[model samples]
Target: MSTPVTASADALHRAATRKAMLRLIPLMCLIYLLSYLDRTNVSIAKSQLAIDLGLSAAAYGFGAGIFFLSYALLEVPSNLAAHRFGPRRWIVRIAITWGALSAAMMFVRGETSFYVMRMLLGAAEAGLFPALMYMITLWFAQEDRSIAVGWVYTAPALALLIGNPVGGALMQLDGSFGLHGWQWMFLAEGVPSILVGVLLWFKLPERPHDARWLSKQEADLLTARAVSSGTGGGHDASRITLAMLKQALLKPFVTLIGAIYFFNQIAFIGLIFFTPAIVQQMHVKTPLLVGALSSAIGVGSVIGVLGVPRIQRWLQRDCLLLGLLTFGLIAGSVLFLLVPTLVVRIALLAILAFFGKGVLTLYWTIAMGRMQGFGAAAGLAFINMLGLIGAFVGPYAYGLAESATGKASSGFFVAILASVLGLVLVPLLPAALRRADAEASQSQRTSARVMTADSPVV
Candidate 1:
């Protein structure tokens, strides 16, 4: 069915796509790596910082979790604003300001200052994920976005893999310049974001049309693909209203996906926030030793992040991916709960990270399937904002449990319970997405009829 000219054009299209991905993805991945590291490096600092700052278990947990409270509150508005202004300016602002706040964390003398800084940090970083994804839509066609996102989501896995050891090493910098090692870590890690933010102002492009790196032929192909892929509901960025955003959030499909995200993130956040201390309790005293042990989760997660997309394609069904992730979560939880030994617990934690991160990473694919334009963009922000509420609740609850029991085991059980809850929610998605698609179709037809009625006869 293909002629020589058509085949040549197809080959050219593939080459351009590859080139665009190579040029754009590395910097983006680095940015996302910093985002995760800046937020979660506190995990490595947990024990030392708590002692240095005289914070109780509960107070520390609340401060750590408070970041998500502000994140949830501002995520939707921030994402919408980023959509309006363009990713180049908005993402840069987010990075630099968040970096400043993260660097300012060295000033925490007590709980009040700690809480204030964490809140400020959350406010600064809100909508970062959605804004980045919005930029992906501008740069890559829809069909290619999954692969692009798959690569980008690797940042968190790599952050954990690299950040844990580096943060551990930084934790050893205790007498340098009269600052605590944790303080050194904060200042050192925070500078990269500031540097990268400045670079983004010049390096990042707002749209494909604006990318000087893209050739004319390549740009023409991307333009055609972008228009075709955007035919559903994505093209008109300006017409996005508050009502549409509200509707998108309230939709049953969004709610269903939100529920799955909520439960998984509770376990994910709680585990990441508390794991360093938990591993330290297993006779691992030094920061580097504890960090290396805890990095098992990261190892499993990287494998899951890189391999799950191919697995999903092989399985050829969305439901299978959801089901597999749910099973992994439940199984990992139950195994860890049953075995009280340290080695088994560590292994089980890897299993949890593998499935949990994979599920969380790939879920956007299903959620974004029916979404096209402004509504989809805002909807993603709202859903992620909703998920952050769970992140806030999970760590706070685990900290309370740990505080009450005076043991890390109790806090870990809370994570297991959160994972168990996913079984109930994962089965609800296929039907909800279908119903949402049907409603969207009906609304489009209704709009067409109204427009026809308003038009003059030819």
Candidate 2:
């Protein structure tokens, strides 16, 4: 009888996990793909935007970077709102507002309007990633967390891989309604997010318990997993207190995660904002060709994000994998500077994408493992907010380098230096995270004992 029960439980777990993945991951991927494209499509539009607005490289960079300022500032609050209101409604709100703001880019007629619109768009999109991370924590178990994150993260790479060419093609509609190609791209891309946000209202559940598609057994199993994993399903997951927030903020691992992410974004965001310019500097003149080549180079990011699970098995250590990735970023940046051939340059960018974007899942998985409940919600947002300040710095620094030197490749110096700084910090992650995990386990154990003692006897 006991054996039968054990077998039954195992079968249910497997079936439920499969269903959860099917219902959630693809939609999550689609949402992120749209989100990423809306934010970074400015890159493909840079040349024309600059010409029309009479903006220099530095000014354009400043405007692009300003988005992150508003984004980072509002990230924690936005996430807290999502945590309180339920991600189902909050995420929809974020999506619709951001989509509208993004579409409004079509109306920016000057540098000032450009900066203002970009910042508004940033504010609207703030906390979307952390909210999604929080949702994943509520849904996935510890062992499967990284794999789920990898799949969701692949969407950004896919956004670049697919959206680039689509954007270039849409740009061809520049004069269709007397709007510029860039304007057309913005309007076309932004509308989908709004439609998708509405669809999510009907499709997405507030929590595992609320999932109508899941059988009672599956929902119970998932909720049990969430509670045991400290991901928050019961009373403990309810409200984040002042002490909890303070404690999370003071953790060394949290600080380290923020620092490492900051440095990494300097390279990753720099690449996103400058890749087309870098390609154009390589003498790829046409917008269509530039988009095609940029998309081709983005293939490495897709490979890197999708390969995390297998790569984790091969590496057997997140720290080691992280070290290797950062080193790869450094090597690729150095080579991109040394190599003048167009093919080699594109290849180096691909390599950079591999290492730069690949590190995201590894680091996020590590961070998420140590957080649970509303703490996970607030903590993820805080770390993301702190780290993304570098996103601002990255574009502005690269733009300054480009403007000062009149050379696109000169901007790579920022990437190289930032990656090296991140590498130096990699050695600290293991110890910090280990300490955090141990503390979290002890707290979970204590909570379990308290709940067990309070339970009514069968």
Candidate 3:
């Protein structure tokens, strides 16, 4: 503890890791921002698309929800390919393909074409999120993981923040170059992803060791940290045997977290797809004002992105924070029902957005801490794949509800129930993961125990 050399080395390692984060995270954020924007811009286009293509709310929801089916089907295969061929190459390929498909929405003449294009876009974008998560696992230590993930998680919120207003403006381009405003929005928003994919190709490295920007010492230290299977840390690929992979796929945490994410995603994605329509119903007729109002929800989501960690620190418990966030979802849903005024409803929606998007940081932090290497690739994909069912159900069911009741808010009751179900599973997180205070010391002891158990006779 008193050694100067040891302290210096630790400081250098931290610096290097910070340097890597500075270089990579911005690009990652931009890519994800585009990804989220392209997927959700359809929400803004919903009304116009309905007018142009004669798409019912149910049809629009079905088309939007259908993306997850293809995405879920391909998630594992994409992650596995990333592990084999490198996340850099695979992610770039995915970005390009999806961006092209997203742009092609301009060509969809009817329901069948709309569904086909959405499915193709989903298939193309399948593994990008988990692949990026895996990359984070490889570069950052467990303790640094939350911050890294939190930063990345903000992209979607930022996408909404920026995309909604911009999409609304693009929607105003109603007859520009003889294309519909929705068509213009699709074409305009989709190109950035392809550009960002190209940027990632030259900018990103295959591994920490391969990063030209990192000093050898920094690179080596980061690499060691990544592979260190300390008490709370992740395992190296060396431990990723077939049995271990199978066990990982079957882990209780994976299934449980997947289920939890499934529930939350239903609520979150439902809100994303329908918030504009809801705003339109609020007597906000102007698309720009609607976009601006919708963007306020993004502002709330960003606040949650920033607020979650601060709240986590004060509470000194991840599990408690998780519980509270889920409860926030439930409360937001209840408020959505009780509130009658337009301003109050908008404010409450933001609060709901805060909880909805904020919970993601907690979810991934817990999930990433428990997995690594090939198992992580498979496990993360599996978890996300399962959660995507909720993504599908969120919009589709909301559409059905909207059609049945002629009210968008009628679908929020489902969110209330789903969040409640997720809350019930909160106490089941492993004891060590639940308590922040125990993690460092407990991890050290666990690491020591594993070493002792594995030691050969001297």
Candidate 4:
């Protein structure tokens, strides 16, 4: 702690890491923006698409949530493939495939075709999120991870902020080239994904060691730091045994981690897919206004994302903040039901958005802190895999609930239940994090971990 020369080298590492984050985060974020745009633009297009194809509300919601089924089915295997091929290649494959399938939605003339296309898109895009999370761990240190992740998470918000207005505009292209406006919108939004995928082939490096922008010193530093951060110590390509996988499988924290994300994603999924419907039901029919309202939600999400690091910096107790945020989310959900005024509903939605985004953003920090080696990848992926079930449940159940209740926000009751489930799981986290932190610290100090090649991700 007192050596000037050693301190200077430490300073150099931090500077290099920050600079590298600036370089990498934008590209990563842009690719994810494309991913979110393709998936969620369907939300923007749903009203038009339902009318054009004669889909019932339940059918539309079914189609939307059905995407996650295929996503869940393929998630682990796709992540396993990405871990084997490297993100540079695997991500490009995911991108082009999902984009092509998404664009093909222009041909969906019935419920069957709509469901089939959505499922295909999910299969094609399965591994991108978890792979990105795993990659973040590789490139950024524990200290800088929140910043890198914060920027990356904002892409989804940006997608909605920008996508809604733009998708609304594209919706005006109805009947152009004998296609419905929703068809044109789907095709238009789908193009960027293919373009982003192509760019990534040339732009994204598989790892720090492969990055042209990094010097040898920087690359070595990052690689060393990653290994030291419970990445199986030094065996980056080591094989994981059945026993290791079984042990990771048996961790109670793994189930709790999945529950946290499950609740967070379900809250968001209900909002993302059904907000337009909710707005329109309130007698707000102008498409542009609808899109703008959607952007308001994005504004809330962005604020929440950016605030995570800042609040952590200020309070220095992220776990406490996480607990508070979880409770806040439950309160927001309850208010969503009781609030009747439009303005108040808007504010409550924003509050819900804020807590929803914050919890997920901060959650992985705890998750990663507790996990190590091959099991970490599995832990992350399994969390993602199970989380998609919540994604599936949120929209599908919302549609059912909306139909049953005969009110737009009525479906929010289901979201409340999900969030409550998540809250109940909260007390379990601290003790679990303690166990994980102890395990991770011990693993790092003893250099006793081994990285599993083909370690599947979320």
User: What are the RMSDs of all candidates, in order?
Assistant: 2.6, 2.0, 3.1, 4.9
The best candidate in terms of lDDT? 2
Estimate, for each residue in 23-60, the C-alpha lDDT of model 3 and write its tens digit.
88887888988999999999999999989999999999
lDDT of each: 0.81, 0.86, 0.85, 0.78
What is the C-alpha lDDT profile of model 4 across 1-458, one tens digit per residue? 56997687688789779877887888889989999888888887777876778877778888899898899888877776666667679889989888888888888889999899989988898988878877887777777777777888899878867888888888888888788888888888788889899999998887888988889888888877776666534224347566766776567778877877788678678778888788777778877777777676777778888887678768877667877887887788788777778888877877777787766778676566555555656667778888887888788888888778767577678777877787777787778777867876786556533444345666
TM-score of each: 0.93, 0.95, 0.92, 0.93
Pairs of residues at least 3 apart in sequence or in different chains that clash in candidate 1: 233-373, 234-372, 234-373
Off by over 4 Å in 1: 1-9, 230-239, 440-458
lDDT of 2 by residue, 1-458 (tens): 69999889878887888899999988888888899999999988889988877878888888888889899999988998888888889889989999999999999998899999999999999989998888898887777788889999899999988777888788878788688999999999999999999998888887788898998989888777766676764224355677877876678888888888899998888888888889988889888888889885569899989886679867779889988988998888989888899898888888889888888998778887777776788779988997779899999998999999998677789998999999999999889988888987797799899999999999
| lDDT at residue 333 of model 4 (Cα atoms) | 74
Query: What does candidate 1's lDDT look like per residue over 1-458, in tens digits?
Result: 56998888778778888988897888788888999999888889889877888887788788888999999899988988887777779999999999998998888888899899999999999988888877776666667777887888889888888888899999999988899999999999998999999998888877767889888888778766655565233535577766777776788887877777887788788778888877887788999888888887888778778777777777768766887887787777777767879888888878788897877756776676666667667878878987898888877887898899877656767766777786677778778877877886897799899999999998
- Alpha carbon deviation, residue 398, candidate 3 (Å): 0.6
Q: How many clashing residue pairs, candidate 1?
A: 3
Query: Residue 124 lDDT in model 1?
Result: 96
